[model samples]
Target: MVISNKSNRRHFIKKAALAVGSALLLGGSLLPASVMAELGEPEKEELKFGFIKLTDMAPLAIAYEKGYFEDEGLYVTLEAQANWKVLLDGVIDGQLDGAHMLAGQPLAATIGFGTKAHIVTPLSMDLNGNGITVSNEIWEKMKAHVPMGEDGKPVHPIKADYLKPVVEEYKKEGKPFNMGMVFPVSTHNYELRYWLAAGGIHPGYYAPAKGDITGQIDADALLSVTPPPQMPATLEAGTIYGYCVGEPWNQQAVFKGIGVPVITDYEIWKDNPEKVFGMTKEFTETYPNTTVRVVKAMLRAAKWLDENDNANRMEAVKILSKSQYVGADADVIANSMTGTFEYEKGDKREVPDFNVFFRYFATYPYYSDAVWYLSQMRRWGQIAEPKSDDWYMETAKSVYRPDIYQKAAEALIEEGTLSADEFPDFATETGFRAPQSEFIDEVTFDGTKPNEYLEKFSIGLKGEEVIK
Candidate 1:
């Protein structure tokens, strides 16, 4: 029953029409005009998408499991990648048609930060699904600096400031304050750096131009890459004292009693963008119809994930835990997926926006979101050289294709799969969000003014500064 090609589709429809005595029409002539006009037949029907085994990859899984891809005339195979680099490589090599990627991967790739490839994303996958966790030993030391609420619980939005003294103590003891993030260009890296630097603890910098991509030059806290699934294990092994990663690894820390997640990214910056659906720019250009249709299917999945106040999240958890997708325990996956995030053991709090999939137009790939990642890249020295605000805007536009997202969204709207209200108003949308000022340090970010936003940071590079 796999309708992989148009010829097979035509044959199936013809046979069904004949068997059903003209009840079904060939070429869908009897379908509504809107459905008929929905993006022409997918230029390429068979697809294989890659994703890491993280909760944010849910939209891709849902699209495959719920038949959304099939509805779009796509036959998709979802494979979980070993790590971010592998996933990115898969897409670049065409072994994978696309992938659920760290928001920075495509941008970094396009700008020649790591691998040089013109990667692009037409849809963002989710938002605010990441957390920074400290090992139990680190948490115990940090507890002294963290203020307690009247309820005797640690007051939250736990700033990196609370961790500053511990970092200093480690420094005085001649111990490097080491931590883990998933990758160099990962959102985890920047968010961890952001959180740490906000607390007056330097998380170091990357001088790629000087061959110091280690990101630990002149550091107070040394951060390294640890795969997402290994965060808890790495913490337990004492290889790293803390890490920032997406779930359910953070929750796995709580479940295993090895670590405590101190802060979710939602607290670091409210509603910050996380993963994106990335493909080679060549893939999109070669199969434009297929690209739009893939976006269409994922958009529908994102809507279903958030609709009715996450009524279907437990079901999603079940699907995600089945050993082929996220494969974490159902309880661990549900810890954040079901609108609540467990920080310390038994310290589960209501963080309804922790794992945003579709609400607030999460699926639309905004230029502003791309710019924020770029700003972080520059701030942390991944970009090496300073550029004007116009360069930032142009680079974001190159990697984030909202035009393609609009096409998919409009097609969905016309086909009655979703409503216009569910999307940004295409005509008025500037692809930039209004200025945001919700970071732990309260620095405002107007995506249009990336250089200005970078200048506001006291800890990282700004202006014409280059890592020397």
Candidate 2:
């Protein structure tokens, strides 16, 4: 009889496997010599990973589809979580093995921001896959203030300064100028705030200590959380005038002609770190072999993504379009993935470095990147209290584990799967990048000194400052 019961089916399969094994032994056991000598077998072979429906989640999908995970002797199930919090909680609660998480999630968690947990990341996912987009109406109001080029197209990197007048006009009408970001601790929130504050617009603050997490105190424009996929619809409903989100949603807005993408995060801050591969610190420590193998698989996938000048991006787009993956249309995902980003409806431009995955040592989880995110949190009051430079360094080291990343890269190099030249030189590698000054406002940020970095911003909380 055919067994419809799952338990019975499993039992039958187990018995069948044992019988087959016994026969094989009776028939003079034949097994190939082992090849997994350098790196031991994964402590846990089956894993369930979670991700949101954004394009930057490509590393997980690519690793699964390209057989990189299996090549590492791991059976991974990639599930799409409802949102960021859900995805994070899944990892914390042991429902998920790991996830494609925000760069700030692990840091914020370890520092007791939203959900208190010891989350850590060994890999930085793709970089520069996010953009700031505005509703067509907002664009129309702001376009008049934007300078035009010889082709009559609005000049590139259309600064939020142009939108300041539109915000003021809304203020004059007693209407709240509302905008959306993925999460409060998200890079999107900080990027949106940075662009707005750079334009002399107050994007507001988070008074978490005072129980005012609305992030709208003393605000010129009110910013709130909206899931990435809902951003375009929220704009259509007039709930928000603009949003900063990761791809294909921003590109989706351009394709649907409902909104205009104003600036990519690449323009806001060149090669900025975006998503990351996150797991609970306990999980990594308990399953060290599995964690290393997981990072190794993802590292190979990331390299494949940016390989040969993104020659594999089109195939990557197809995989991401599958219903089990990003589930966006191939064209919408391709709009940004293929090295060109459509800003205004017809203003498609070449932004080859728009979605970097492996080039420029982008895969390394630099403590400096973590420090930059923490500095923004303090600048905007998410941190609530002043912290010393050493505190910032310690917090960054706790969350962004480059030691784990280095181990994975070394294993990949030893296996001949990747070359040592493709990765950062582990011998002399420092976790910090040289001070970066390419912000929209040209503000130089020294990750080694976060409090001093906060003092550079005029619109944010500096040293010893707390929300009143």
Candidate 3:
């Protein structure tokens, strides 16, 4: 397998030689001829970026490996950080020019939630690349509650209600039902909480005001932070019963036969936005051309990942398997990256939309996506106090920069590398997706009316509410 993959890598590199040569030749050139003829050179050409070892960080890897960054006259060094907080702090303190970040990070930071700093994202990284997995014992207990399919396999999109009985049993036995999420303000935290709440379980709350930031107030299930790569081992060691995390950790569990991934975030909320490419707002303002160029390069990489209906994903899996990147076995990463996900050991199913890269306008950083993350932060008491709908709107506008994204997209379109139709219609785009009603609870979300949407949730703090 190693010999075969090395041969394939050499072939892949040979095939890309022409493109790489063109990029190197074009590196010194300022703006692409057609679209941004007037735009000046990138102020900073040598950059060091950071990313966690996750598959959704593929755009950064692809851009760097495929010469997209060099094509834009940018010399970039990509480094893997210790954890999310360290990554965020690196960007904050100028140690990193940018990073592949959780979608909630920029929003939470801009709103002064955790480490307060004005961070912003020009492009969303990817969508729906996460899943929830349970320890074997927990799955065994919940398996009876899950309806079986005609093939005798457990039904999918398995609602958390099945887990509810197990949690109750644990509670009845005077035990604390513990779970893990990637971070406090992560999509994992909110999605896990959303799934649990939808199933009539209170995953708990945060009271930053009272310095009780553990987020265990009024809880049935206690959730704590466990870094993504450590999740499978953590669960196997009985540190956490189940965890919500990005791939290929979930797939790792299935591969090791230690846990079963019960549901994917795709089932929790279809095509939900996941990670983003984030930098300090100061960095963008100081180097506008560099920012637009960074977006342009990543836009090209994203298109490549999703082009021809993901025919290139197998190649991507090989790139991601390198020791410097995800560092997981190629097969484990391929389990979901190649468009199928494994729940139980042998229960693999085709889920083509499992890891959306460029399709569905996933690269565009919509304000609506920002709003959803903020709503989750607010719903879980991270906000500490209630604010008006206008605040949500204003805050989202501050963090998500579609204007920068548009400049990049238009540049790509003008270069004939991408088509105008491939993007949202810039002339009429409003930066907001229409009302969506595909949640586990069938709750509708309209980005423009965040407070009203929050009011509809049976759980979570709504208007005028604060954790006491």
* Predicted candidate 3 versus true structure: per-residue lDDT over 1-468, tens digit per residue: 111122234454564576657777978332355555645679998788899999999999899888788777677788898899999999999999999999999999988888999999999989999999999999999998999989999987899999999999999999999999999989899999999999999989999999988999999999999999999999999989999999999999999999999999999999999999999999999999999999999999999999999999999999999978899999999999999999998999999999999999999899899999988888999988888888888999999999999988888887778999899999999999999999988999999999999999888999999988
Model 2 poorest 10 in a row by lDDT: 1-10
With a 3 Å backbone cut-off (N, CA, C), the pairs that clash in candidate 1 are 161-199
Give the whole-model CA lDDT for all candidates, comma-separated: 0.89, 0.89, 0.91
Please write out the lDDT profile of model 2 over residues 159-252, one tens digit for every residue: 9899999999999999999999999989999999999999999988888888888989899999999999899999999999999999999999
lDDT of 1 by residue, 359-442 (tens): 998888999999999999999899888999999989999999999999888888876779999999998999999999999899
Please state the error at residue 456 of candidate 1 in Å: 0.9
Worst lDDT 10-window in candidate 3 = 1-10
- TM-score list, all predictions: 0.95, 0.93, 0.94
Report the number of the highest-lDDT candidate: 3
**Candidates 2 and 3: which is better by TM-score?**
3
Q: Pull out the clashing pairs in model 3.
A: none
